[model samples]
Target: MTSLLLVEDDAVIRTSVSLALERYGYHVTTADDGLSGLEAAQTGGHDLLLLDVMLPSLDGISLCRKIRETSQVPILMMSARGDGLDVVAGLEGGADDYVVKPVDLPVLVARIRSLLRRTTIAQPQPETGQVGATLAFGELSVDTGSLEVRRAGQRLELSPTELRLLLEFAAHPGIVLERATLLRTVWDYGWDGDSRVVDLCVQRLRKKVGAERIETVRGFGYRLNTT
Candidate 1:
């Protein structure tokens, strides 16, 4: 059975989701607050994470940021409503996807399965955890084999997920890649994959490699501007 980590503050909602997910053939481990969620998340055992954006103790955003630093664990954010800002924030915080409150169990299950598919595909070299054979665009250099990143002679240190994301973008330089496509390929995420994850990672990468390196296609996808 696929294992999952569910983090939510509301007791009733958490219980309901746990039950629903359990019925769908998932082993669910839940946390009531962001602090506990972060702790559980770092244990590094679960297959996917279902996080609520509005969390008590530490807040989901911060926890997400911290986790994104080292692990590429698929994260699915939950919000109270279909609030765009919250969705964006969750994505920016490193969540792979988001679902509005009053979640649809069936839909959520579908998303999880999709994420799992991507995850399994990415597991081709399951034990290696290495990628990005040779990425270069306009002086920016990334060595996936050695996990080395640099731009214009300046060395860059990025989180594991961020490095994979950059490699994915570099692999398709000049061609626009959808946000969801990036999520699934780079981060192993599925379901309602949020654009914010791409947005935030791009923003962070921009700050490092220069914003001009990444082009936003708006409503389509993102591309690396080698020129």
Candidate 2:
């Protein structure tokens, strides 16, 4: 059974979601506020975290940022407000994924499953290409096999999502990958409306990997600067 930490201020939500997830065979630990959630998260042993945006003491975004500082555990942010800014903030804060409030159990479970798969699935080496080769672009380098990224010989810490996005770009070199394609390939979502995840992820990736390394193509999409 997958272990999960659920942090929500609303008692009703906490209980209902906890019960629902338990039925699905997930071992869940609940917290009513961000401070406690942060404490539980720091203790570790959780496969994933379902964090609510609004909470007493500390907010979800801050808690998410705190967790990211120390751990790469998959975080799924939940918010009652479907505001674009909230979603962007959560993702920017290091959440692996986000789901709006009134979450459908099936959808939430699917998201959880997808995140687990991404973290646990081993990438098989491709035969045609230099599967385990490290690609270098200017001062930046990406090791495919180890998934390590470095700039000017300094190692850079990246989340699983960011690393995957970087690898996808490195694989194609100068190719301009469409947002829809990136959504499907990186996020595992087919909905065209889910492009924000791609955009936010790209923005985060640019911040870490350098903005100049990824060129925005105005209306088209984005391309990696190989030279």
Note the Cα lDDT for every prediction shown: 0.79, 0.86
**Model 2 spans > 4 angstroms off:** 121-131
Lowest summed lDDT window (length 10), candidate 2? 121-130
How well is each residue in 1-227 modelled by candidate 1, as lDDT tens digits? 88999999999999999998898888999999999998999998899999888898988888888888888788888877758888888777767666787898867787677666655544424346556476778889876565577889899866445666677777788999998888777655645465566788788778878889999998998898987
Q: Residue-wise lDDT of candidate 2 within 27-111, one digit each (tens)?
A: 9999999999999999999999999988899999999999999988889999775577888889888898888888888879988
- Residue 71 of model 1 has an lDDT of 81
Best by TM-score: 2
TM-score of 1: 0.73
| Prediction 2 TM-score vs. true | 0.91
Model 2 residue 66 lDDT?
Answer: 97
Against the hidden reference, what TM-scores do the models get?
Answer: 0.73, 0.91
Off by over 4 Å in 1: 121-133, 141-168, 177-198, 217-221
**Which residue pairs clash in candidate 1?**
none
